[model samples]
Target: MKALKHLNKYFFQYKWYLILGTLFTFISNLFGVVPAQIVRYALDLVKETISLYFLYDGFGAQTVVYEIFAFSILLYGSLILIMALLKGIFLFFVRQTLIVMSRHIEYDLKNEIYHHYQTLPLSFYRKNNTGDLMARISEDVGKVRMYVGPSLMYGLNLISVFILVVGYMLSVNAKLTWYVLLPVPFLSGSIYFVNTIIIRKSEEIQANLSKISTFVQEAFSGIRVLKAFVQEEPSTVAFTKQSNIYREKSLDLVKVDSLFTPLVSILAGLSSVLVVYIGGQEVMAGRLTPGSITEFIMYVYMLTWPMIALGWTTSQIQRAAASQQRINEFLNIKTDIVSTKDISQPIEGAIDINHVRFVYPDSGIEALHDFSMHVKAGESVAILGTTGSGKSTVANLLCRMYDTTEGQIKVDGFELKEWNVQSLRGQIGYVPQDVFLFSDSIKNNVRFGSLDMSDEQVIQATKDADLYNNIMDFPEQFDTVLGERGVTLSGGQKQRLSIARAIAKSPKILILDDCLSAVDTKTEHQILNNLQEIMKGRTSVVISHRVSSAKLADKIIMLDGGHVIEQGTHEELMAKEGAYKELFEKQLQTEETNS
Candidate 1:
């Protein structure tokens, strides 16, 4: 309930709907009770009319009695119909207002979560998986909707109907009402005992279901890998084992869940028995009418459903509370990154990394230590390193994916932290090593860098990336839709498409983190030459292991174990016979061997 308080603002936003819905509940219940009263009145009138007919002793008043009785029955029957109609209309309004409000809240809540997700730093994604995040936003929110919609609506109906129906019963005969209620304590005790078990089992079932869902989602996504390894039989066995666990937990819940109906039916039967047996004595003693017994029985049956719904509604509310707590946990988390001011000006791509040091917070592994670099506007610099050399970390910092643990990075003479996050990212085009393309048309994938890019610019960008001929060969050309992560394309094609996407925007600064590794030397040379033209006045940083990628840069910096070991032009580095020359020769020999 404390966690559920987060929804107070939404409830207040839709306060009028709640107020009106609640009002309708009572109004509907009020009309609902009137029908039972009408039944009692008609029954009494019938008995009195019959008694008067016998007392008249065939005085020819039989026709008058029959006509009067018939007319009264017709009038009372019409009134009962009117009562039922009014009750149903109010129930309709109750759903219209309450249920609609819940749906609106659902929409608002999902958007809020997704918007927050966008603001969080990359570290958050590293710490959590897609399935968990999706479940919080989708499944948890649906549970909350159930609480706000059906649980709330039915709860109000139960309170309204129970009070009105019980109050009227008491007014008719207090003693008989007490007798009919004898089964309530027994039912209450049984519910209290079973409810604890139901709550525990429900939680287990939900957890197991989430686990199974994640397993199934991952299996489908990696079906190709599974088949390649020939592990389908083992995978099926594992899945079956998980499914059996889920089934066992579900059956346990069903055992407790299935108890409510018979328990309610039996209790309601007891109440009816009390009504008929106890109330009949009152009628015989001339203290009550047979109509009174029938009314009490009708009220008992009327309360049956709400009584049966008790455990279900309680469990629903509890689950909703738990789910809302999960939602609140994410919402309350402050994003590590925040957008700074000064977004009005454009960057000129001058960059300075001053003795920067960074360590991954999750693993506490240092990625960079005392790294420094300087690049003037329009100059291309290449950072050369092998795996674990922290070359990619330099790109990540430039994109502001994570802040440096020591020193500071400046862009256009201003610190990276001082610039607006969005404005800063917009100026830099980054092509990551891991190329990810959406399941969308090739045109849209290229246009992702800038949605408003002209088609001509997209075509030119693809040409520059050396992928124009291949795209044109496809059946749909620009409209060709790729599979998940662009699996339809070859590895080199995917990498080049990612390059095209980055260059499509014509950003002031370009950061390519080994994005050209998948292509051959010939294609790499062609794209690098094309980039030389596109980056004529734009700053560029290429991080790669290949010397071919770094030889053309205005300056090359080679890194080893997170520290800069050498920095110079290609001619100067070769003259020195240092580490850079050694690496360049090694890669050159490998390329020659492959050719």
Candidate 2:
């Protein structure tokens, strides 16, 4: 019930529909209970011994019993027919209004969760899996809808029937009504006791289902790796174990449901037996007539449905409570990266990192410690470092993927936090080491950064990245559809495609973080030559391990252990006979030996 509080706003938004649905429910139940009273009157009229005093005096003197019976049949028969028709009509409206409202709410909730997912920080994604989140959005949302629609409607219907039927029975005979209702309190207590267990088991079942979803997702995504390592058997075995766990949890929930329904049925049966016995004794004592006993029995039969419905409705409510709690947990997560202040002006690409330090949330060691650099506007600086030397960390910081833990980062003289995140990111073009492309055409992939990019612009970006010739060789060229994650392309083609995407953005600052590691040296040199022209009058940061990639920059910085070890022009560094010169000589000797 506490978990359902999140939906209060939506309920209020569409309160009119809910109110109408409740009204229809009440009217439908009102008409539904009228047939029992009609049956009572018909029984009294057809009795073998009729009291003339109870009938109209003129009709009693003028008409025979056969004439009275025929008259009663025509009048009561028409009334019952009309009541049934009205009940059916109101029931239709009740279903239409409340059920459709639930679907509308489901649509809104799905969109809200998806929008929230987009705004969450990258760290949040790192902590949660795709399949688990999908379960929250799809399965959990559906369970919540059950409570809003059928559970609520049926619960209200049960209450209406209880009140109307009980009032009618009490009017006829209060003492017999009390005796027949003896089992109700015990039945309600039983349902309450069973509901606690059902709620706990339902939560466990949903969690295990999520685990199975995650297992299937991960298995399919990494199927190629499993086959390559010849570990398919082990993966299958693991999947079977997870499936078994899901089955066991589901069976446990079924067991609780099995117990609840039968318990409710048995209690209802006891009430019916009590009604027959007590009412019979009253009829024999001359306190109640036969027709009155018959009417009381019919009312008890009507009450049976509400009791059974109580069990089913309670089960739905408990299950929905468990699911709503899961969904609310996700919706309540506060986004860590949100703009607190507005920046009106666009950014210029002069980046300054002033003694910044950053540590990943899950790792205790710092990835970047006391690292500082400055690149003026229109300056092209190359970074050279071994693996784990904070080269990529610098690019991440400039892109604002993660904020600095210690110091300040500024673009165009504005602090990273001072500028709007989207505006700041729009000016920078970053090509990461691991490129990711959608399953779309080459042209669409290149133009993804700017939806309004022209075909000519896309072609130009591909040519600049040295990918135009490769794309032209395909049958459909730019219209060719790619496989998942661009798996149809070779490694070098994928890297160049990534470059083309960044180039198509035409950003003010371009950061290439070891994006050319797969291409041959000849192709790499040609691409760099082209980038020299494109990078003119634009700030650029190139991170690479190869000297050939860094030699074209106006300046080069070498890093080790998250600290700058050297910064100079290529000729100046070579003349100084330092680490850069040593690496250059080593690479030259290797090339000579291979030749």
lDDT of 2 at 189: 87
Q: How high is each candidate's TM-score?
A: 0.94, 0.92
lDDT tens per residue, model 1, 46-76: 9999898778776888878888999999999
lDDT tens string, model 2, 430-461?
89998899999999999998999999999999
> In model 2, what is the error at residue 527, expressed in angstroms?
2.4
Q: How close is candidate 2 to the true structure, as a TM-score?
A: 0.92
Clashes of each: 0, 0
